[model samples]
Target chain A: MNLGVDLTFLEFLASLPALVEWNDFTVGLVAFAVKFAILVGGLLQLPPLLVWIERRVPALMQRRRGPNRVGFFKWRLYGLMQSLADTIKLIFKEEVVPDGAHKVFYHLAPVFCVFPAFLVACAIPYGPDLLVFGHKIPLSVVRLDVGFLFILAISSLAVYGVSLAGWASNNKYSLMGSLRASAQMISYEIPLGMSLIPIVLIYGTLDLGKIVEAQTSLIHWGVFAAPFSFMIFLICMFAETNRAPFDLAEAEGELVAGFHTEYNSAKFAAFFLGEYVSMFVLSCLAATVFFGGWQVPFVPYETIVALAGSPNIAALAGIMMLLLKASFFMWVYIWVRWTLPRFRYDQLMSLGWKFMLPIGLANVVGTAVVLAVLRFK
Target chain B: MNPYIPVIIVLIFGVLLGSILSGLAAFLGPKKYLKEKMDPYECGVPKVTSGSEKMSVKFYLTAILFILFDIETVFLYLWARTFDQLGWLGVVEVAMFVLVLVVGYIYVLKRGALEWD
Candidate 1:
């Protein structure tokens, strides 16, 4: 594996027969299992961290100390376990099934919502390689050629789950919330998809690993090469995840509790967890795709990799750097949510169709012209 | 290259297992004959059964139209995937398709198919 370049498990596996080791698929599967286990374990902590961030940061911005009283006196500053306590409290709360709600669809909605995030994570390459039974095993779960498209399709599916949840709830408010969410998701998806095109065009590949690798070449980092597309992507991603400024569906002043209004207990928790996880995943994706994934900017690849002593250590460092970058994005999300006020529904729609869409189109044209000129030169 | 057979087998097995379990549960579960539970209640009023229901066809028509356009978008995805092999001509073809769809959308907007009374 090259330093500062993203390499998926399959790419490593394809080169493995030349290297001296290796029995068959069993080692590969076990390595994959380990990577997946770690990803899930690490990912589970994000919601707790996000909860603490969301609760505390908003208070800081508003000139108050939020969640300070919840933690032990010694740990008052950190109140990290406040989210854990909240989870336990939510779990023990009585589950309620509202009358006239479509029982099947209502029950299925949370499962639908959560699964997409999990599936999308499979394409995300976290580390370089795993050491299993004295053999080096590649770390990613799976890599598809159409990984980017797969994520996009999964995002689209999330809207269906939300829509079904709202429509099946049989409540007027729930229906309205779902309707708003569906429209918002569909509208944002256009720009989100469009914004991705310039990067894809620049990289000349739809595979996410390849996209990240393209960025490691220094000059090819999509953000620097095409700033307009990056901006469009960032704004669209915010709207896509239904964060503040674009969270009309969950606008508490308008729709009470939104699509999950009648939901309770674990089902409600599932929706909440799914939302936070999706938010984390989107931020991670933005970091990886546009900001050059795990690569340290301006530092030559050889210097870091040589200092790290081996490809394995270099890969581990890459994973850590990627996680750090992703966490920073998560913090930024909390910061923005607290800092910014919500947009009116009309403003949100206009931003999507009237502004972001045209800009995204322009970015694609601009990228093509630049690439063509470079080729000609 | 073909992962189709295994995928199909898994799908079939899943559907069969789900159907059997749910079917058996429905059959074996306690069958309590209750009047209130069986009857359709709208705002707690006992509903008179069986009549030619007065519902507008427009709602159903719009839903059908939405489904059609949604499926057309799926075809557009396929075109996108193969666009490189099809070259600039493929781009033009897709543009034409999207243009036609936009025209249809405009027509529907003018006709107020999207409006909810």
Candidate 2:
């Protein structure tokens, strides 16, 4: 367990002049362009898939057939391409702008909503160091010093879009919906960030990649060591993503269609896409922070790569493993969204402020005391 | 890789591209200025007296409090990093710092600063 900082980033650059030189900037630029393309395409497709997921999952729970009639190849695949077909159908449809709507704000809200999710995706490590023109480039788009804080801040900004959308809509339901969303997000954010303090305390760094590296052993995963923080994080993550039991903002019975009530066509679709993408981002953040992120569980990295795979291949496998975990959690978002009813506003507030906040603070103090005692022992 | 170079380029490009594309969209999109269409209103409601006159200040107050206390944790983080170098004295210093902050928090609590009206 030799844990001292071995090499500063600058020292690594100095040692490997060829590998980390000016020429590598070209590789980084190309990788950035590729990642941007992937992000845009993924955003375009994300909403339709999520719509399909919402329908199919709820139907399965309630014993009904869902979207089995839309695609050309019908019953065999149960209209798997329904989402693709639906998206294409949407593009040609007329975008409706209401008579008194603030045109500029109406147009700008979708862009604001979509971009945060796109920005956060760039921080997630996808594959290993992918080679291009004989230069190895890290799969992540950019590594920022304040990666976690950037995510939290950027995510919080989406509420402004929702709030503005409601204010602009001139509808009672939409206003109520947006106001509910704003209050809910602001409240849960405290517990979410508080719970993360234990992880940052344990790892001693906010860099996502470094945190992932520290969880090399099974026991080091924050969930096992700080179970209370893990539970609080999970609960708050669900609320942050606006999943069921916490989704009072969009409760259809009360607020008809919620914040995007007055929006039609592409603007309507943007809000939906923003939601699922944010869901994936939250799941990925949890997986990376608390789980043993791309590190292979129970197997030493050197031996696994040596015995059955190359270093590059093993790294790719690990990245895929992390993505798989994230995807499973994303599905769970759909599952919970269908399974539970929306909470009352007072119930939601009490749950976050009363139960979650105190529990999270206690967890941080508990972890600190345990660590300090173990150091003395 | 030479990380600073990439980060600089991204910052520059993001700013330049964002402004250019937004400008282009404004120029290219149709401009139809009608009294009924251009007026600031929503769902037939006039914009002159829209939105709640008074929102809960409690929400804003809590947010401010959260950010203040959260930022204070940064000092504890620094102390944790240098705990060995500072020894028991450093630990005592941090404890006192936390104690003072907690007292300030308690004062705010007793004053009902966090209470929702």
Candidate 3:
């Protein structure tokens, strides 16, 4: 209610050095380092595991054995180690630079592909704030007030990598694939962003952390409050990520491996890793936005604290809860990828512009009208 | 520790990781570049035409449309963030704004800007 005195998380962080003692600075630094390590490590480690899941889940669905031959000794662990073996092989394999390729952009494309994925991850809040030595430290790396917009802006940069890869490759298929990728991402981004607006309208804030806190219970979750928006967001998310049903960018039937067709070795692996990491980040965003992030449904923070009798345990539980929700969405990614067939290029474009865009606009208008009527009462 | 400081650290870390991985492969990987291997892959057959030709105008149309609609979304975000304080007036204003965009969208569709052959 005190609009004049309200300070954003960035402002609060800026004021820390002035208020804290010398010893407290050391503590803060140490805590920051530890949090950074955990966040970065978990993000980097997840894609390989996802690669394993992507393989094994589809295999089970199709009644085929997938990658059951890469593990130490006799216990193969259902070929979970296949990702590791693939990484090793990629690291040592020979890279091919196609003749007549634009050498600079070709090499730079993979770096551009991978960087934005990790950059977006930096804004995602994985757990509730932790109380350390009477200091409340947020579990996210950054807490920008405009965090949601920041995410959209950073992610938009990812198209450059694909587009550049296509242009720089000097290969026809790669060019087509990249063009499809840019077009798909650009088209879907409208509905993806439009669907998110109603939630922002309802919550009246763009900070993802505050959005999660607002949805403290299942009933308060954005999914229930704006179900249509949730559906639109989920559909658009698939298209944005270029996953199944919307993965025309890499349609194997025509494009032959898509944008990365000419890429090889670790350069190729960068694009591969970037795709999975982007998937992970998008799933996490879904969890944070629609689901009650870090909050157990039907269970409040007080109940969590009461049950655990310690803030640390409760925070850990919150992290696990968020991860569980995010991982489920990730599984849905794989499930949908295998279950549905890829959309034709025209069908994909029409769906974005005709269906999703109109529905998303209508949802925003509907939410606004409903809110206004409720307020006038 | 500024909140954004961690974000900077993460960005630097990402760049480093990408460069290191790519650099390691380039240094360690075998290099026996054959002329045939360096050529663009076309199902292992000989090339028909050069790859770097001017693309379709449809891609350019999509890019222009993306910029137009994306700007509208930015306004929507700003309006949503301040909706509660701005009250019903804000709702009516944004409604009209969206309505105008919807008309443009309809025009685009009718004009077949989104069509692909």
lDDT, residue A219, candidate 3: 90
Q: Is candidate 1 or candidate 3 better by lDDT?
A: 3
TM-score of chain A of 2: 0.88
Q: What would the per-residue lDDT of candidate 1 be over residues A1-377, giving only the tens digit for each residue?
A: 56886878898898775675557455555455566667666766777778888988888888888886567767765677788887766666555555567888877787667666666666665655545456765445565577777778766778867888887777666776777777777777776776777676566677777777667666867778778877887887778778887888989887876787767656676777678888888887888888888776776455677897676777777788778888888887777787789998767766665577556655655565565556433
In candidate 1, stretches whose alpha carbon ends up further than 4 angstroms from where it belongs are A1-22, A72-74, A129-136, B1-117
Which scores greater on lDDT, model 2 or model 3?
3
Residue-level lDDT tens digits of model 3 in A1-377 = 46787898799899986776757557667777787778768867777788898888889999999988888888989898999989889989998999979999998898888888888987888888888878777787776788999899988888999999999999999999999999999999999999999899889899999999999988999999999999998998898888898888899999998999999898888887788889988989999999988999899988999998888788899899988999899988999999998888888898888898889889989998998898754
Top model number, TM-score: 3
lDDT of all predictions, in order shown?
A: 0.67, 0.69, 0.88
The sequence of per-residue lDDT tens digits that candidate 1 reaches over residues B92-115 is 566576667668766766776555
lDDT at residue A333 of model 1 (Cα atoms): 79
Which candidate do you rate higher for TM-score, 1 or 3? 3
| lDDT (tens digit, per residue) of candidate 2 on A259-327 | 787775555666666777888888888888888777777875667678755667777777777888777
Clashes of each: 0, 0, 0
DockQ for candidate 1 = 0.10
Q: What is the TM-score of chain A in candidate 3?
A: 0.92
